[model samples]
Target chain A: MRATLMYGPGDVRVETVADPKLHEPTDAIVRVVQACVCGSDLHPYHSMDATTDGVPMGHEFIGVIEETGTEVSSLANGTLVIGTFSFQDNTCVFCRDGFQTACVNGGFFGSHDVPGAQAEYVRVPFAEGSLVPVPDVSELSDLIPSLLTLSDVYLTGYHGAHMGRVEKGTTVTVIGDGAVGLSAVLASRELGAEQIILMGRHTDRTDLGKEFGATDIVAERGDEGVAKVMDLTDGEGSHVVIEAVGHMPAYEQAYGVIRPGGIISRVGVPQYEKAPVGFGSIFGKNAAVTGGPAPVRAYIDDAIPLVLEGKINPGRVFDQSVALDQVADAYTKMDSREALKVLVKP
Target chain B: MRATLMYGPGDVRVETVADPKLHEPTDAIVRVVQACVCGSDLHPYHSMDATTDGVPMGHEFIGVIEETGTEVSSLANGTLVIGTFSFQDNTCVFCRDGFQTACVNGGFFGSHDVPGAQAEYVRVPFAEGSLVPVPDVSELSDLIPSLLTLSDVYLTGYHGAHMGRVEKGTTVTVIGDGAVGLSAVLASRELGAEQIILMGRHTDRTDLGKEFGATDIVAERGDEGVAKVMDLTDGEGSHVVIEAVGHMPAYEQAYGVIRPGGIISRVGVPQYEKAPVGFGSIFGKNAAVTGGPAPVRAYIDDAIPLVLEGKINPGRVFDQSVALDQVADAYTKMDSREALKVLVKP
Candidate 1:
């Protein structure tokens, strides 16, 4: 099987790898139909050390179940499915509470023991619990790109909106311009936010954000960005602030732009080891701060219908597509800002 | 007018201060019937320096309106009322949004210009907005002590529950056993929580907590305390964790006990300037951290009715009482933990 592997920093290659097998009765063999380079993939791509072993990559994918183990009862071969970034047993107390990302027996796809999604085939554990089948993939064929996003990005954006308590008449300020941030803009609008403000400096992304229901844009960063959003909100700040960037400064921007009694939902994977959440930071305004890895499986059931019905088009975030052999070019293009997101065909 | 004044660290005196008079058209002069020394008072009570001027102390009080300025329309002379820790116009954007504590024109009770509640008389700014009048005080005379608590502690507790999203059937863990923590136990019950856990080491306070509706009490500290709570919730953690202690360890305990997707509402005045809010700390669990100075005024209307009807007895937290000349003794008893709280009569 041909798969994308990361050798070291600034080194990526498409190489033939051993095929995955069903080692457990609960597992299923999935033939990858479509996969994409994710933002988090850049973490190891930019910093893989000298002695690091080549690692297979890609966590987001849509596929067809090529084979199913004896214990996998719900799914069958040829079932069209969307596997979330992480696999879950879906019966743990946490998963039952809709926090599948924290499931007791969950595992991520590109782990050392698991084959990555940017390949011809991958083995899925807890197959029935880990997969959400598209009811009629052929009927919804044209919505594949949008449906693929539910595997990670769009679901994450929806999580941000949901966490921030975005709803009808809510004034929302999204503090990022990346694909997730743009997806959050769409999610906020879908949640019926009265005013959607996108804070980013990129003309290309901001233009897309406007099309996605961003009523206003603030290109400034840090304090300046906070000031611009506050000015637009008549100095009271937005009712719901969605923090799509997970760095300290992004968190600071969110704290500064949230109105008293408002919520700041952060979805970006945090980069810092510690952040101040003391009286002066969050307690003074009676604000709320929450966010984490999206439980995409929990959300897929509700979000897929929206995509299938054409109520939202978060798939537009993918601006370029490349063959599996061109994964390196896709990375280079995304890292250099030449493309919003790159879709890969296996 | 006789008032409690802080001249230096460990130096409290009963001094004759100028009687309060209406200063603004929206002001009202009130004769305090009851006042209490707050936990926050200890901050300055133990740290006043040689260069520091004498500052009047209390902020919690129930009183009778003595006079009203020309523009004060709603409150009449002799009206029995509860004055919140801070005074606000109640018309600012923040106040309109139910965050009266951050109102544009609001000010605390113990400021240089405003007389503290420990004084015989206080000139309350924005009288119509700052005071919640008790309907037919004579009929509810026996409930005065509990009504007095609405000014701060009880309201603060309610704020914690509300911020943590306490609702029917919620499992709540209160991280302190102080008056506020016990009040949170009571507030959690009022908010319809099914199982309430109080985490503290003090037998006396925990007894009070159980009386206030604590279903369980965990006396451990640090990781042990977290483990105890996790054990209580089937190793998943509580649905709403209310942090009533204002220090770093208390915050850490809150983070440890909150279930994934749970809320941590902290109302304790923070002792530190910065606390960690990183990925390892909060993001991975998808938990929420929120709270601040309680919007006591916003909750007064609903809470007061319950207190007035003798349905809740938060004033039991006031375990000691002192006359005007014995203000120093009241401080000593409360500071030494001999009393959960102290009521002062001026």
Candidate 2:
């Protein structure tokens, strides 16, 4: 089996690796049908995240169950499924409360001793709780990207909007023009937000954002960007602010554009060690800060149907696709902003 | 009229000042029946807050309306009312949304030209919107202290619990031993929390917290404090953490004790300029940070009845009393920790 491995910063290699097998009674083996290079993957690619030698690299995938362990009765071989980034036991206290990312018996894919999804075949722990079965479709060529996204990005976008409490007739400002940000725009529209503003300078991303139901676009940055958003909101800030970029400036921008009593929901993997969440910045406005790793498993069930029904086209973010051997170029394309998302056909 | 003035850091003086008079069509002049030193007042006294020469000090007061401007219709001469720290016109967008602290065309008491409530007679702007009237009772001697708390501390406490989303059966951990922290314990009980823990060091304050419905008290500081709280909460942490102290350490304590998806509601006037709200600290836990300056005016109506009925005794925090001439001594006592809260009779 071939898998993507990162030896160090700016180092990515698609090399032959040992195939995955059942490691636990609750585990299942899945043959990867589709996966992608996530923005978070850039954290290690750019050397921003600590990485050891030869770590398996992906956490998003949709696949077919090839085998199952003795204890896994809920799923069978040959079932089509989507798996969240972290494998969670659904019965854990945190999982029951919709915080599957913090599940007691679960941890992230590609982490220590866990096989990643960016391979021909991968072992999925806690299969019954971590994998969501999708309807069997005769042709999956078009649905693969969208289904793959439900494993991470799409659900993360939904989580941002949900945490931001975007409601009907409310104004929403989504910072960052990445795939997740565009997905947030789509989710905000799905949640009935009356005005959706996408803050991005890129024409390519903003074009997709507009198609995702963004009512406006602010090309400015920093204080200028905040002023533009405030101007659009009639001098009061937006009712809900989605922070999909995890830098200090991005957080500051989100805080700056949130109206009094509004919420700032962030789904971006934070790049900073500490965010200045002070009373002078947030308390006087009575604002709130929420969002983290999305409970992808919690939203996958509801989100799959939307994609299945063709109500949303989150797959549009996949502007580039490549074969397993070409995965290295895919990372470069994404890193250089030449691609919105890179679809990996294993 | 006599008022407390901050000539500089650590310099407080009780001096005769010009009596207040109606200045706006919506203004009213109130003869302060009672005023108290707020925990926030200590900010300027301890040199943590910027102090200017002769700045009148105080924002919490219960007073009798002595005069009303031509446009003041809801409140009139002789009405007893509790004034929030800031005066707000309830018609503003923020105020209508229940965030009176961020009201437009409104500002805090003791700010610039705005006279502080800790004087014989103070001019109140936006009288009808800023003041909550108490039922007139002939013998009001015993009810004065409790009603006075309605202006700030108690309402701030209630705001913390409300923002933290304290529900019927959740566990609540309040971080602070000040008047506001004690008030939060009382408020959490009123909000129907099944288990309440107060984290404080002082025997007197913790005893009062227990009386206010604290089921447990963790007297440890720093990591030990968090460990004690985690041990009490089945090693997961509390469902709701109330940060009644405004400093960074209190905020960190609150962050340390919150469960995944839990909320930290803070109301203490933040003395620090920035707080480190990192993803490592908050996001993975799926926790939230909410609460600000209490929208005291918004909760005053419901809270007043609680105080009037003796359902809560926030005034018990007032362990000492002083005449108007001894207002300087009041600040000293509170600053030196000799008094939990001080009551001033003008």
Candidate 3:
């Protein structure tokens, strides 16, 4: 079997690896239809932190079930499935409360012992919990874009919006233009946000933001950007703000755009630096900020239905796709900001 | 008219001062029937910041309206009233949203040009918005206690509960057992909290807390206190926590008792320092923390009505009273913890 392995920094390679067999009864094998690089993937890509050697690299994938273990009843061989990057037991106390990522026995694919999905065939554990089988598609190509997005970006974006309580008539401000930010704009629109402000510097991404329900865009950064957002919202600021970037600037920007007693749902994966924020931003303004990692499986059931029903086309953000062998090229394109999201065919 | 004036730390004096008259159309001249030493008043008394210029010190009072300006129609001359320590227009956006303390024109009396109520007569501004008239007074003696608690402690405690979202069947934890903290136990009970945990070391306060509806008491401090609270909460923590101590340790204790997605409504004045917090505590825990100096005016109307109807008896917390001539003794007794509340008659 051919699998993509990351030996070290910038060392992504397609190599012959052992075929994965059913190691656990709850595990199933899936033939990858499409997988993609994530914005979080950039952390390891550019990080100085050493990772597990001879590691499988990608996480986001939509695939067809190739084999099922004895305990896997939900996923059948040949059924198409969109697998959440993070797996969880859906009935755990935390999962039942919509915090699946923190499930008592939950695990993140590709990071721990679980092999990732950036291969022709990959092992998927807890198939019933991780895999959501989509409807049969007449054409396989049309499935790639929607399937790719459903894995992580759409659910993560939805997490941001959901945490912020973005409802109908809400004024929303998004603080990032990456894949997750664009997905949040779409999710906010889906939630019926009357006004969506996208703050970023890139014209292409900003345009994509507008297409996904951004009524206004603030190209400035930092204090200037917050001012522009405030001006656009009649000086009261947005009722809901989706903070997709976890850095200091993004935190401040999120705080700046939320009105008193408003909400800031931050889904940005914080790295080394703790965001520097004072009482003025979080307490004095009386904003409620919430969100950690998205409970993707908690959302995939509902989000998948929306995709299968064609009610929301999150695939609009996907700009390109390439053969799985060209994963390195896709990374460069995404890293260079040349593509919003690139789908990789395996 | 004679007023209680602070010459310095432990140097309160009763002396003749110019009688206050109508200062604005929104003002009324009140003959102070009773005034009380606030928990916050002891702060300046105990601190190095203690002033010595004979400043009048009390902000909490029950009084008879002696004169009214042209625009002061809500309270007639001779009407008994419980007035908020802070004056607000009540028509500003913040006041409409029920945060009268943050009102555009809101101003604290006894601090700025507005004189303290520890006098025979003092000017009350925004009279219509400031005073809540009491119609029934069969227990006129309760007036001093009711009036004493109304302006500061009771409202502050209610503010804590309100910020914590104290509602029917919710479990609430209160950190601090000063007068306001004990008052919060009462407020939480009135709000229908199913289980209440009061953190206090003193047996007297814990007994008062239990009477005020505290189902559990944690006598330990710091981590031990948190452990005690957790032991009582079945390991999940409470749905709401009220912080009434205004110290960093209390802030930390407040956060410790609340569950993920819980609320910590702080009503303490944040005396030690600006509480150090950031996006992580808020976003990661999915908690909603909202509080400030209590908007006494926002709640005074309902509270005063309750007091007048005998539905609430904040007077139980008042341990003693004295004439304005004994202002120095009042301060000394309160500073020595000899009285929970000291009501002074003018």
Candidate 4:
């Protein structure tokens, strides 16, 4: 089976690898149909150490079940499905409470131990709880791109908005112009935010953000960006600030543009371990900070119907696509900002 | 007028100060009836720089209206009232949204310009918005202590419980054995929390916490405390952790005892300017951090009824009393931990 592997920073390869096998009774073998590079992948791409045995790469994908372990009762072979980036036994206490990302029996894919989805065949653990069967969309294959986003990005954006308590009449400011940020603009709009402000320097991405329901855009960064957003919001900051860029500057912007008594929801995986949360930031303003690795599994069931009904087209984030053999170029294109996201066909 | 003044670290004085005069059309002069030393006052007491002129101290009080400026309409002379530590024009947008502490025109008492409440007379700005009138409690004088707590401590605890979303079936862990932590225990019980774990080393305070509805008490700190809490919760952690202590260790303890997807509500005035909010603390757990200065004015109306009906007795936190001339001793007692809290009569 051909799979994507990263031997070190700036190194990606599509090489023949042993096919994934069901290692547990709760596992299922998935034949990958579509997968994509994630912004988070850039973290390792920029600094991952050289290794003899490369680590499997990619967590998001939509596939068909090629085989199922004996105990996997709910799913059958050949069934089309989408799974969360992290596999969980959805019946766990945390999962039942809508926090499947923290499921006790769960673990993320694409790690050294778990073969990733960007491959010919991937093994999915906790099969019944991890995979959500999808209606056959062979005739409407265009929906595949959008549905694939539910595996991570789109639902991550939804998690940001949901955690921020975005709702009717809320003024939201989203920091970052990545696929996740754009998805947040769409999610905020879906959640009925009255005003969506996208803070991004890229006109191309900001333009898409506008189309996705951003009522305003600030191309500046730092103090200038915060001033622009405050000016747009009548000197009061937005009710909710969604941070989709995993960096210190973006997190700072989140606090800067968050209204007093409002919320700062961060879906961005932080690049640093420390941030200001004292009287000067959150305490004195009576604001709140929330968001994390999204409970995408909890939202996938609902988001699928919206995508099917044409309520959203999150797939627009995928501006480029490549075959398995061109996987290295896909990483290069995204890392160099030539593509918003690159979908890979296996 | 006799007032309490902080000359420097470890130096408190009971001095005669000029009578407070109306400085704004919205101001009202209140003759102090009962003002209490607060846990926060210890901050300035421990590190304040020496000065020729001491700073007025104290922010919690219940009193009788001495006089009112022309614009003060809702409150009348001789009417007993309780006001939030921070005066706010309750008509402001933030105030209307139940965040009076962040009101645009609001300013806290006990600051350089605003006179503190531990005086014979204090001038309150935004009188109509800041003061909540109380029914004559002369016949039921015993309720005065409890009612006075509405101005700060008790309401601050309520803010913690409210921000943490404590409700029926919630498992709560309150850190700190101070007045606010005890108040949080009471608040959580009132809010229908099924399990209340009070983490404190002081048996006297923890006993009070138990009386206030703490079902369990962990007299440990740091890792041992975290271990004890986890053991009590069957290793899942509490649904909400109310941080009533503002130090980094307390904040760390909050993260330590929080369940995945839980909330860490902080009413403690943070002594530090930064804390860990990276994946290791908040993100990985899908938890939220919220709470600030209590919008006491917003809850005063609702809380007054609870006190009047004898449903709560927050004033029990005040275990000692001092006359106007003995105000200096009050601060010393609270500072030395010889008294949980001291009530000053001026």
Q: In order, what is each prediction's RMSD in angstroms?
A: 1.8, 1.5, 3.6, 1.2
Model 2 regions more than 4 Å off: A48-52, A138-141, B48-52
Report the lDDT tens digits of candidate 3 across residue range A88-183: 777776677677775666778774367777778878878888888875763276755775687889889998898788999889999889889999
Please report, as a residue range, the 10-residue window in candidate 1 chain A with the lowest summed lDDT: A44-53
Per-residue CA lDDT of model 1 for A91-171, tens digit only, reads 998999999998989878886688799888989999988888995886237788898999999999899999898999999
| B-chain TM-score of model 4 | 0.98
What residue pairs are clashing in model 4?
A: none
Error of 2 at B142 (Å): 1.4
lDDT, each prediction:
0.88, 0.88, 0.78, 0.91
For model 3, how does the per-residue alpha-carbon lDDT over B156-197 read when each residue is reduced to its tens digit?
A: 899889877899998999998888889999999999999999
| Cα lDDT tens digits for candidate 2, B216-310 | 99999789999999999998899999998888888888889899999988888777767756676788888999989888889988877787788
Docking class of 3: acceptable
What TM-score fits each model? 0.97, 0.98, 0.87, 0.99
Instruction: Record all residue pairs in model 3 with backbone atoms less than 3 Å apart, i.e. clashing.
Output: none
Candidate structures ordered by TM-score, highest first: 4, 2, 1, 3
Docking class of 1: medium
Candidate maximizing DockQ: 4
Q: Kindly state the fnat score of candidate 1.
A: 0.88
Please, what are the lDDT tens digits per residue for candidate 4 over residues A1-346? 9999999999999889787877999999998889999999988899999988998999999988899999988887888899789999999899999999999999899876788888888899999999988956652388999999999999999999999999999999999999999999999999999999999988999999999999999999999999999999998898999999989999888899888889999999988888889999889988999999999999999999999999999999999999988989988988999889999898
lDDT (Cα, tens digit) per residue for candidate 4, span B187-225: 999999999999998888899999999999999999999
